[model samples]
Target chain A: MTTTRTPKPATAPKLDPKSRGQGWGHYPLFALAFVGLALFVLPLLGLVVRAPLTKLGALFTTPALLEALRLSLVVSLAAVTLSLILGLPCAWVLARYRFPGRGLVRALLTLPMVLPPVVAGVALLATFGRRGLFGPAIEWLGVDLAFSTTGAVLAATFVAAPFLILSCEAALENVDPRLEAAAATLGASRLRILWTVTLPTIRPSLLAGLSLCWARALGEFGATITFAGNFQGRTQTMPLAVYETLQSDHDGALLLSLILLAVSLTILIALRGELRR
Target chain B: MTLRADLHLTLGEFTLDLAFSAPEGEVLAVVGQNGAGKSTVLAAIAGLIPLQRGEIVLDGHLLERVATGIRLPPQARRVGVLFQGLALFEHLSALDNVAYGLRARGLDKRSARARAHTWLERFGIDELAQRRPRELSGGQAQRVALARALICEPQALLLDEPLVALDAQTRLEVREVLRETLGAFAGVSLLVTHELDDAVALADHLLVLDAGKLAQEGSPEQVIRAPATAHLRAMLSARRTGSTPDPGT
Candidate 1:
């Protein structure tokens, strides 16, 4: 069928933009975009291209590799769980409710996400260290977090919790406050309304936040290593494992890097697909 | 279900200092312009906003004195509100949306679902139970909103710009449904509307609000007979259209 809505091409503008009297030519914007995209993909492409294909299966199945992978999953999941426990409510306060110095609190929350991972590690060490102010007292209560698996989880959490909080805050901000009002008028207590109404409305955002938090936690390098130390079967995550292997077995490091990439990509794809439906 | 509110609430530059009451089964329609604090009154009564100084007595009990914040967190207030957009949960099915208040009140899941189905049936949208709010038409969503609010058997109902979200044709039909629904309700009803026809249809008492104060309050016949302000007159005049005024004067 010939569509009546088809445009008259004969009356269209000239093919040559130069002759059409438009001065537009080279775009710095496109150049900048291309450079940014190249920077993003270059390291990943290098790792894939330089992989030791002959020892790929062996590298993946090694006991040390498997242990590190398991630890990475455990710590990342723990970090994400703890972040949700703290971040969702912190985000609610930021987005919906208001109090004094709220702007300062929000800024401080985001600082962890943007600050260098090494700097975050230093900050955590200063505040929660054995010799630190609140740290010695907590340790005396038989809770030894430093250089333990739990320490790794804490480090990851400190670095990644901001991702969840910021994302969920934006989601909550976009929602109409009227719905909460409507729920209350219906005789639902505050907690009930949160679970039944507020939470579901912001699920897509919460999922996005959780996914970001998990990815950040999984790939955590500097913070985990500095706070918990790199132990092959305990505190060594996939990223830390890759770094340790790089100084000796180049092939092992590349294989482990690919593993980290695969794991994070699989998780994000699954979560995004689940939330889409 | 006689409710009385004597409030002095302030937000930014807008202030609401007014006193009013609506007897049980009475329709109190508040008419006002954009910035006339129409929504502020609803928000304060719903416990979404704070009251500076005054009391809101529902039936006979003081609702404003039990301060955790705004008396009771929205749920405990038991005042049904229909926001301008209806604010139906997009993720929830129509039946679930209607049943939400019931389930939130600790009703079992099975009973909540049954009650929701009943409300849906009452609103004549039973077949659309599984349909999410996003999939519903404007009129259907409004009906679901009505069912959602009314199912809780609230002691009082507050509706803000109920017809604003509907199409011209749908508004005409929905207004008739709202009138029927209001007639069945034994509780007090406060509907805020700019449309004269909608107010004249459902409201027994007309309250004209101007500059954060009650400009006039009287029966619809009296309010329409001599609209107090020029703004009120313009509203009635726009709909005059050669329709003769009642000569019962």
Candidate 2:
């Protein structure tokens, strides 16, 4: 095993021209970026400034607040789980297979994202509410979805699953099919290839998608209130509670808003590194 | 093992019709210029592409038959391929990459890793087993890919430009490694390359393809001495003018 061969010398590091210098022409773009940054931060700053910091402890201890927070956590987590279970396969189909009317299917799947939240609520009701399309069959099964916690979860999932689907599809699309082909040549079945190669390759994107879906579910308001009919300890999540307290208890509403903002910001920050990579 | 392939594939304006066979313990080199369907023939045999109207039988087993609508998947074909780019799993360590086929075939992880280590030792890459593909040099990666392809003891081996990515020194080293390995392998093997030196050095038989058809097929000495096609003649002339004569040539 002994040989006189020498390891090759390390190559010099490449210098990027773009990193060499900053030009004056970039100022306008920087300013525009700052403007976009301000657009997001200003409102958050306003919420923080108007928040009743002294009464935050008491506000947080209120029964309605605690119940809403708990409900929001449960419903959003359930929505995220449902989205991962359902959306991942849908994404794989959209990304890997070619079929007729694929464009139409993708557009329809993403429609809820741009549709008004209240309109989405109405649509859900028309499809699943009592006296609606499948309502009789569901009732025959002794299952009531509308105006229940299940309805709230369904509402959140309807709006948030699209984010997961789109992100996961993009990630799957970016995966090198050659790797899958290589795995197949090594005698791996289709499902095994997906489990060992495809899924691991797109793990970062899956995490990012999960975080986005959960955050969207956590902030769901109009749809849940309209379809689930905000009950005190069952269907009333954080956003619904904020709406209810907005008129009579402005400080309470502010506290709830602040809490939602903090939680969402924390999740986004946690996922930022993964998304960037 | 023996491999018999009669492939007829049509893509848009291009049509590829080819028929070839290789017996056990023999290396068949397929050479052609760009667009001569060299890679296509290998892919068709490997079950990566479907044949429009043909049959591929390996060791008396029908791997593909267009008339009967029978096409076994790549996994069921028991054909190993070393792709032109090697296509090593970039995220896995070299040992893991070599063990992938064994694991896929239901071997336990411990035994697979142990066998992969033995293969790595044979290839003189035992110390580099922990390195990922990106961390390995071109020659090192080629050895890992070779071990991965051969670990399954495939009935047929298809190598697509196996040494084209390496530098001259590394190419010579890898060619010697491949020559020794293929010499000892008892299954049918087909190598696709654009370099005449590769064919002359490693392959027992040569097939020259021109415009999607076979132009010449014979022993390397016969083909090189009396080239039939203009492309073959030009290649021979070019090789004659070159300074260093390949050892096999």
Candidate 3:
């Protein structure tokens, strides 16, 4: 025999009109968003459709393509590492401190992000090339940057460092200054507070910045070719290789293009969790 | 373990000029309405803010003196502060949060965690050691913050509205914990609170501040029996009537 219990009195659940989910009223906005999104994804879709998938295995084994892939990976990773080492302090200074010409310094630092890639390469050459400004002094120390692998890394860094700096600076700005004060009261020194509090607090943004910087460096073309010059197993990255193969071997260029696209998509997907947080 | 502060600071249209002292083993409650420079006074004592003039001395050490241009940084002053929001490190576990001071003072990781664990146990929060700050309830967070402040054995402690963020029930519970802890502490403690009940319950001496100046300073009983300023008189009457006092009045 089942026991019977009295039902408890209940009131109607409140429904907030403002909190309601999407309905017919949201359809126009949703359509516009989809259209805006399609503008970004359509080119990739086109590339995927035209790519020679059947010969992908054979294309991957091409010596020049393999060399370009390896060099691109090495140079881009180096560029990202360089960006972190140099850009983090710059970002920290910009975010936390105020001094003379701060606005001018920030604008100058971010100049390369919007400057044409070719112009950045020109600037790099003018600063570090054999006959360029400071070039003679640099060569005196037995260092050659222009038309070398080092030049490729430098060019990529010139274009990508600003992305990391901007993201990291914004992240630092978002952290509560009171937290640092708390750390100070806890007997933490300036560097200690940065390591345990400030840096950890902004870890997600740092990761986001790293991925963006790496991806930007991976896709660097105009700057690399202009300053470093495309040379197999040396300065030629995937983008430069793809550019060269476009004239002689369309299939090879398509394969290289697909590889670059795949790499960027994978990195973005991996960083989605960090970016969302 | 004594704190002597005479601060004169100017921020825009507002200027703070106040002087007070708290000897060892005493809790001096700095009571004031909002924007009355209560927090600013604490910040100056903690070395977070600079004084335009005047001096702050802790146990004969010159922490700050604008005349001599001698001001020590916060870390070197050995002051522990509990902010209004607690300001517990969100990234760290409860144990690590308590251990932060020990680690910052150059203690090894193993020993710091061990010591931190002991402080957690002292606060009856050993079970929550591995949990992050956001995971703990308000009272638990307060206990953890208190433990963190006491762990370093600071020369002076600064508490900013420690019980203001808690619920009614939790406030009573945490107050008991704080009363016991403060009673045991040998160092000077400066408690900043807006609630008159909190001041009466915790502080040995009371200081009523109005418009960046000291309006009244005495024992809790003396302040209630002989209210000096209009603000204090209003507050006493509001308390007697079981109603919250209007800060503006």
Best by lDDT: 2
Candidate 3's error at B184, in angstroms?
Answer: 1.2
Error of 2 at A135 (Å): 2.0
Which wins on TM-score, candidate 1 or candidate 3? Answer: 3
Tens digits of per-residue lDDT for model 3, A1-277: 0111122346797798888865778998889999999999898898888888898999878899899999999999999999999999999999989999999999999999899999998888888999899999999999889999999999999999999999999999999888899999989999889999999999999999999999999999989998998899989999999999999988878878999998998998988988999
lDDT (tens digit, per residue) of candidate 1 on A8-48:
44575659755754444656766797999999999989988
Sorted into a CAPRI-style docking class, model 2 comes out as acceptable
- Candidate 2 ranges with C-alpha deviation above 4 Å: A1-21, A25-30, B228-247
Q: Point out the worst 10-residue segment of candidate 1 chain B by lDDT.
A: B240-249
Write the candidate numbers in order of decreasing TM-score. 3, 2, 1
Q: Between the candidate structures 2 and 3, which one is better when assessed by DockQ?
A: 2
Question: What order do candidates take by lDDT, descending?
Answer: 2, 3, 1
TM-score of chain B of each: 0.93, 0.97, 0.95
TM-score (C-alpha) between model 1 and the true structure: 0.88
| Model 3 global lDDT (CA atoms, 0 to 1) | 0.89
Q: Which clashing pairs does model 3 show?
A: none
Poorly placed runs, candidate 1 (over 4 Å):
A1-32, A274-277, B65-73, B241-249
What is the DockQ score of candidate 2, to 2 decimals?
0.41
Candidate 2, B46-74: lDDT as tens digits: 89889999999999999999999999999
Each candidate's fnat: 0.59, 0.47, 0.55
